[model samples]
Target: MTTLEQLLDLPRFSDLEILSAHKNLERKVESVEITETPDVANFIPKNAIVLTTAMIYKDDQSKMKHLLDTLVSKDVAALGIKVGRFIDDIDQDVVDYASKVDVPIVKVPSSQPLGRLLYQMLSYIWDAKTEQLTYALDIQKRFSGLLMHDVNLSRFIAELGKIINAPVILLSPWHKVISNSQYFSRSDHPASFYIEQIDDHHYDKINEGNSSFIVKDLKGENVQVLGYPVNVDTYFPFHLIILKPEQIPYPVSEFAIEQAILVLTFILFKNYKVDEFFDIMKSDFLSQLIKAKTDQTHDHRNWVDLGSRYGLVHSKYYRLALAYCVPNKDNKTKLIYRQEEAAIAKKWLEAQLPLRIKNVIIFKVKNTNEIALLFQSQEPDANKVLQTLADELKEALSIQLCFAFGNPYEAITNISSSFIEAKSALDEATRLFNPNVVNYYHPKGLVGLFENTNEESIHYYCEKILKDLAYPNDQSQKELRNTLKHYLDYNCEITKTATALYLHRNTIKYRIKQCEKLLGLSVKDPENSLNLRLALELSESGNESSEQAEPGA
Candidate 1:
C-alpha cells in the first residue's frame, strides 16, 4: 500500500525532488531495484521503482528517451537518478518525454546512495504487507468464530455486516429477501429499491461464469453492490450481497467476503438438508397411514401414535384435501411442479395458515403434481381459513391450484374413505370444466348421484332431454345452451345469471324464451327446470369424458 508520494516523505529521503510527472507520484511502489545495465527494462519487476546513475545513456539523448519509454511500457512505478555524479543534470528532451508519458522521475543527490534508497523503499513495502496480513488474519478469526456458536441465519448476517461495515442481504433464487442486516434499514432507500435494482440478467451472467462481480451505483446512487454466489454446485443457490458507499476508495477485502460465504454456505445447506429430511419422514408417515389396512390384525392405536408426531391426534375430526396445479394463460405447465417451487409453496402455506387450524399435515404427493393435506376440522371457521389459504397460494405460486376436500371423519381408519371422496370430487370438477375453483365433497350432489351410472346411458339421457342444445349446430344455439346452463346454475335469477354470463338482463330473458320454444316445455315449471339442469350437467360431463378418452388427449 506504499505509494511513491509517501516514499518522498520518509526521513532519509526528505531532500528528494520530483523532476517530472508530478501527477504520477500517487502510483504504488511494491518493490525497488538498483540497475545500471542498458537492458534493465527486460527483467525489472512491475510496480517497481528503478534507481540508476544514467551513466549508460549520458552520451545519447535518444537512448535516454528509449529507456524512459521502455520503463513506462513495463509499468515501472518511478525512476530515481543520481544527480551531480556521472550526469550533472538530465537533458531537457528526456525530462519532457518522461513527463509527457506520465512516468515519475526523481532526482537523487550525490550524498544519497542508490543502495540506501532501495533499502528504505523495501522496508516500507514490508511494513505495509505485514499490516495487511494482520488485518486478514483478524477477519478470519472473527468470521470463523460465528460457526463455532449456534447462530441462526439472521444473526449470522448481522455479524457479517458488522465485520464489513456495510449492509448485507441474503437472497433466495427468486430474488426474494431471505434475510437482511440491520444496516439495510438505515439506508436512504428501502430494501425493495435495492431488490428491484438487482439485475437478474446480470446475475444470470455471473452465475453462468461462476465468479464474483460488482455492479456500480445501482439506481444512480453512490452505492456499489457486490454479488457473490454461494453453493454454486447446487441447482439454485443463495446470493450474498454487500452494499458499500462510493466514498470508500477500496472495495471490502476479498478474504472477508470469502470467509462469510463459506460459513453461510454451511449454515444454509445444513438447514436445507434438515428440512428435506423431515419432508421425507412426513411423506412416509402419510403414505403409511393412507395405505394401512383396517383389519382385525392391525391395531388402530399404532396409527394414532405415528400420527401424533405431525400434530394428528386420536378422536379428532380430520378432512383430506388434494390439490393439483392448473394450467395458466401462458401455458406455464412446463415451469410448474418444479421440486424447488413446490417446497417453497409448502413452506408458504405452513406459515400463512391461521393459528386456530393448528393440527395440519401437508406433503407433496410422489411422482405427481399434487399436494395432500390432512388437517383437523374442529373449528367452525376452518372452511374460511382454507379458502383464504387457497387464494393466497394461487397468487403467490403464479399458477392456479384446485383443491377438493372430503367430509370430516373422526377415526384414523376412515382416512382412506376421505381420500377417495376427495379424488372423486376432483375428477368430477375436472369433467365440469370448472377445476380451478375450490370444491367440497357433498354426497347428495348431482355428481355423487350419477357416479356409478354408465357413460353411454348418461349420454343418451342427456340427448333425449335437450334435443338440439345437446349438440349445437350454430353459434346462436351454442349461446342459448350456455345461457340456459348459467340460468339454472344461478337458480333461475335473471340478475345473477346476467352478471355471471356478462350479458344484459333482457338478453338472458330472450335466451330463456328461445330455449322454451325449442324444447317445447315451460322452463318456469319446477319439474321441467330440474330436468333441464340435470340434462345440461350430464351432457357437459359426458363430452369432457369422451374428449379425454381419445387417443391423443
Candidate 2:
C-alpha cells in the first residue's frame, strides 16, 4: 500500500526528482519490477513500479512512444528511468502524455544502478506491508477484549474508528445505520441515503474483485469512501465505511475489517436462537397489542417477558408508528418481493429504533406491507425522532412510506384504538393531499369520520342528496357536474377548480352554474356547498354506518 510519493519522500531518494508526475499521486504500488527489454508489449504486473534504461529505443521514436503507451495501459504505478543512459532526454510529447495520464516519471542520477534502485523500492513496499500487518493485529486485539466487557455495538464500532484514525460507520444492506463513530454527525449528508442508491449492479461497476472499493461518498462531495463490503446472508449485507480515507492505511484497515467481520458473524450465530425467539415474540406481541389485550385480562407475564427479552424500557405512554411500504402498482411488485420487503423493513427499524429513542418495540404485521413500531419515548421532541425514522425508512429501503403515527395513550389495553387511529390517518392523508408522508388522524377527514360505518348507509345517503347529479347520463353534463364537485371542494374558487381540472376559469364557472341549476344548490353559499361536497364525497366512496351521519342526509 506504499504510494509513489511516499517512496520519493524517503531520505535516500530525497534528491531523486520527478520529471513528469501522474494526475493521481495516491495510486498504490504493488511491487517493483524491471523491464528487461524495451519491447513495448512486455508483461508488467498490475500496480508495479517499473525501471527501464530505454537503451533499445535510443534511435526509434515510435518504439519509445509505444513503450510509454504500454506502461500506461497496463496500469503501472510509476516509471523510474536513468535519463543519461542511452537516451539523453525524453521528447516533450512523451513527457506531456505521461504527466497527463498520471504516470509519474522519476529521473535517476547516472551513478545510481538500476538494480539497486528497484531493490530499494521493493524494500520500502515490503516494510510498509509489514508495518500495516502489525497495526492490524493490534486493532484486532483491542476489539477482541471488548467481548469480555459486554460493550454494545456502538462502542465496538467507535473504537474501530479511533484505532484507524478515521470516521467509521456501519450500515445494513438497506442502508440503515447499525452503529457509527460519534466523531461524525449525519445531519449534513446522510450516508444511508446515498449508499442505498448504489445497488448490486452499480457495485459491480465500481468494486474490485475483493468487494472493496474507493468510491465517492454518495454525498456528491470530494470525499472518497473506502468500504469493506460484506453481506450477513439473510439478515442484511453490511460493511465498514471510512470517511477520512486519506488517513486510512489500506492494508491495516482492510485486514482489521476482515477480523471484525468474522467476529460479528460469530456473535450473530451465537445469538441465533435468541434472535429466532425474539422474532416469534415480535409477531405474538403485535397481535395481542392490536387486539388490545393487556396484563389485566390475558397473559400479563407475556408482555413483561417480551419487553424484558428484547431490552425494551417500557413507559406509561405508547404511540404506534407504521413504516408502511405502499407498493408501486405500476411497476408490478411480486408477492415474494413484498413479503421480503416487509421482513427487511422490520429488521431495519428494529436496528435503528434502539439508536434514536429508548423504550421502543417494533413488529412486522403479517400479510400486510407494514412494519409497526410502538415507542414509549420520554424525549420531549419525539416527533423529530419520528421524522428522522421516517426519513431513514425511505433512504434505507429506497421506497415510498407512510410514516403514519397515532397520539400517545396511557393504557396498553387501548393499543387497538391507537392502531386504528394511525391507520385512518394514513388512509385519509393519501386520499386527500400527499401520497408518501407522515399522517395524523384528522377528525374532519372523510374516512376518519366513517371508519365504523358500513358501505350500504353511505351509498343510500349519497343517492338521496344528488340523485340526478350522481348519474349524469349526458357526457357533457356529467363533465359539468364533476367540475362542480371539484369547484365546491375548492370553496367555489374558479381558478383553483380550473387548474385542478386543467380547464379554463370561464369553463369552470359555467360548469358550476350548470350544477347549481340541476342540483338546486348554490355553489357560493357555504351551507349549500358543504352539503353538495358531502354528497360528492359519499358518492365517490363506499357506504358505511358511521357514528356521524352525512350533513343534511
TM-score of each: 0.50, 0.54
Judge candidate 1 at residue 182 and give its lDDT: 90
Candidate 2, 221: how far from true, in Å? 12
In candidate 1, what are the lDDT values of residues 1-553, reduced to their tens digit?
5778777888878888888855546677888999988788899889999999988877775687778888887788888889888888887778888899888888899999888878878888888767766776776677668667768889999877776777888886555688888986776665656766667565776466334345434456455676778863344557777776322222344654676688788888778788778878878777677776544555544887776777777666878888765554455454533555556556655666635477777876666556788877566776677677667666533545677888789877778788878877777776764464578886767755886799888878887889888867676777788888888888889998777766778888998999989999988789988889888877784332221111110
Residue by residue across 1-553, what tens digits does model 2's lDDT show? 6777778888988767788854567777878877757653467778888888777767864455566777877788777777787878876777676787667777777888889888888887888788877876876677678755666678777777776667777766665577787666634566565465555554443234234434455456555566665544533446656666678655664566677766655554445456657777776767776774544566454555555765545568878877666667642357666665666666666766677777777776655777777777656755676667667676645655567777777876667777887877777665643464667665656544765578777777666677676655666655765777677778768787677777777777777777777767676887766767777776664322122211220
> How accurate locally, in lDDT, is each candidate?
0.73, 0.67
The residue pairs that clash in candidate 1, if any, are none
Best by lDDT: 1
Worst lDDT window (10 residues) for model 1? 544-553
Best by TM-score: 2
Model 2 sits at a Cα RMSD from the real structure of 13.1
